[model samples]
Target chain A: MKFDFNNNIPIYIQIVEQIKTDIVAGKFKPGERLPSVRDFANETKVNPNTMQKALVELEESGLVFTERTNGKFITHDTSLINFYKQKYAEELTLTYLKRMYDIGYSLGEISKQIEQLGGNK
Target chain B: MNTILELKNLNKSFGAKKVLENINLTIPRGKIVGLLGKNGTGKSTLIKLINDLLTPTSGEVLINGKSPSVESKKIIAYLPERTYLDKSMKVAQVIKYFAEFYDNFDSQKAYKLLEELGLDVNQKLAKMSKGMQEKVQLVLVMSRKADLYILDEPLGGVDPATREYILDTILSNFNEGASVIISTHLINDIERILDDVIFINDGKIILHSECDKLRTEQGGSVDEIFRRMFRC
Candidate 1:
């Protein structure tokens, strides 16, 4: 997982975003084990408590599972990954579309650009 | 559309030191508000005044556009910064007490939450861990389904897992047209869920805005802005 310490966003949220990206990119396959909180925090130079908060949010959202003695692992379900990816994609696309429209882009022109970018499929 | 609570030029002091000064806040219904401030600020005092636990030395506190009275107490559910549960009482007894007092209390929801938290109703408050007690307190406060939910330091002294549970309980239990105020110094953890925010310092409001608009106008995350504004 990657963390940009210089970014203004909170460290925990950055960790969450990176984990989600890894899940979508297949870096963490279904049912794969994740590094323990301490090890991950040590490697990333973040507080263990902050890392724990990110992992807790993931578990709460059903993207990860924690075993008391064993450790946290990626959920054995890609559907959750797909679900989040689609949700995020739709959110991001709407944001982009809004900004484009605010800049006076016509629907036809936007559609054409999207199509040219292989969005029509 | 009535003002659910208002503080008019309220001033409060503890011993020889002044805490809140000329504090005025008017809160409307159905808004989820974040109360942001550093430690020892008057955020908790504001909550206490609303709940009638402490009286303002000067000025006024109103509930539903009237002075805070006994009837106002009936509609407020207060979760304090520290544990308020009687250590000798069992969870079941606490639930029963709350049910007897609150007109809108939902015992079933409380039991369901307890079960989800892996807590048994028969567990004594003294026997449970600190995190478990916090959960119980949250369960009791949320089960009331009051007109106003005033949670002081709701996320204090709890694990993130339990904090999520507490937040979800707050989110799921409140009905439409109900308002909630969560006071905390930990802004980042709860920033995403806040509809509005009131930033307090030394018992005075320094900032108040709709959460999204504040983030957009400031052009940074709430935590970042807070860190800058309250730089140490």
Candidate 2:
């Protein structure tokens, strides 16, 4: 996972966001086991306590579940993953359009830019 | 969770020079606290008083509801800035020393950490570099199953990799219900791990709060707030 830590947001929030992004993006497959908090903390260069807090948040949100005897795993519900993926896509689209609107472009012009970029892709 | 450590109206003086004045704070179990300040602040002095290296001029410092004493010392594991272990002792002998001194010292855990860090048990402390010596000291200190662990500048003069290693060891090794008070000026590096933070300047507590609450209220990281507050 990519770690882009900055001073703008708290580190634990960043961890939660990144892990959620990976799950929603299908980089970490549903039902896959997550690294133990210690291993994840070392790999991400975060404090284990901070990682534990973020994992707790994820667990509360139903994105991850602990098996008591086993470690945490991504949620096995495909519908939940799809919902998050769609929510993320919608959020990104809104962010892009909002930036273009702030630059004085109308919705029509923003759509034209999007289609042009999409064609190039 | 119980309060593991508390200071009430604590003051320290060295013959008319006041180092700390009227400091009061409580540290609860299962928390990692950052004791922060600029140079020449009373951070180290307060730490020393809690660890019983020095006596307070007034008021009291308590560990587990008792004043600083042998009982308190048994429960509090301290790592001062300077190395106190004998330089001639081998790593293996130092482990034995810890085992002999503290009932909670786990020799197996100490040996496992030493092996993980690639330290030779037969290597003499005198032959190791300053940073390696510090790591050895930290390994021994953290090997104790103490209620309170007070570390003063544990990351000083270390490279980035070793810093990460030490921080990881610290986070993983401590026991449940244990409270860690780490005193350092390396705010950015340690801020994320802190559950709460205490800012001491001119021998007074300036700010103390849960770290996330402070972050949300101030809209800045602890390092930024510290820079703004101290202007250093």
Candidate 3:
């Protein structure tokens, strides 16, 4: 995974979002062990406290889970992961459609444009 | 985490000139703090006070709940703004000196880092380039297993590669209960690694906040905000 850190967003938020994107992309397979907080902090070159905070937030959201004696891991619940994937896609699509609509494109024209874009994908 | 260093109502002056004023700060262990300010803004003065290189005019600087002294200095690994090694001394000689003087100093680790930096152990300090000298100094300071590390302008005279190595070395060195206070003007390169930032101007603190919060609130990087705040 790659990160281009921008100062406008909180670093922890960016870290959490990137981990979420990683999960969504199947880069971190379900039930895979996450790196130790210190190791992750070193790899990302961010403060360990901020990295720890990001991991805690991820755990709270259920996308990541603590395994008691073991370290953190990606949630083993495939359904939960799938649910997030669908929700994320819908959110992206809605934002894209809204932008097109604001630009004076009709719903039908937006659909046609998306169909044309699909072949390139 | 326990507080490793604190300055309570600290004040310092050089004769009639005021270098630091009414300063109050606390630093907890396990943090990487940036003491950021422009040139001649008393960053060095504050660090000197903490290291007891200069006495405070009023108030106090504390390390582990006690005033600065030989005892406190034991736990604080200080990298001064200028080179402290004798130019005639070989790199191996300096390592031996540090190992003997500072009980916490790790000569083995120093050798390892020097080798990693491609520095010859027998190199005389006078023969080394400015950047190479800085790298050797950083390696010596970082090898100490101290509770608080005070580095003044560590990235100042180094090349970009040396800067990266210094940052990485700092990242990997600190113990579980240690804290590092770095004084620097290179905000952009260091901001991402800092847990908290202390913005000093004209011997006074204009801002002391968590790096992430400041970034979030200002809607810009620390460097961007610093430019906006201190722009001439």
Per DockQ, the best of the predicted structures is 3
The model with the greatest lDDT is 3
**Ranking 1 against 3 by lDDT, winner:** 3
Q: What is the lDDT, from 0 to 100, of the residue B146 in candidate 1?
A: 79
Ten residues in sequence with the least summed lDDT for candidate 2 chain A: A1-10
Task: State each candidate's clash count.
Answer: 0, 0, 0
Scored against the true structure, residue A76 in model 3 reaches a CA lDDT of 93
The DockQ scores of all candidates, in the order shown, are 0.07, 0.42, 0.63
Q: In angstroms, give how far residue B109 of model 2 lies from its true place.
A: 1.8
lDDT of 1 by residue, A42-104 (tens): 555444545777899899888899988999999988888899889888999999999999999
- Per-residue lDDT of candidate 2, residues B1-232 (tens digit): 3999989999999999999999999988888999999988899999999988899999999888899899999999999999989999999999998899899999999999999888899999999999989989999999999999999999997888888678878877887679899999998887767888999999999999878778878989889988988884
Candidate 2: pairs in clash = none
Runs in model 3 deviating more than 4 A are A1-3, A91-121
Candidate 1 lDDT over B1-232, as tens digits, reads 4678788999988887888988888888877788999998888888888888898889999888877788888788888889867899999999999888788899999999899888989989999888889889998888886788999998888888677567656765665567889999878777755667898987788988875566657867777888889997
DockQ of 1: 0.07
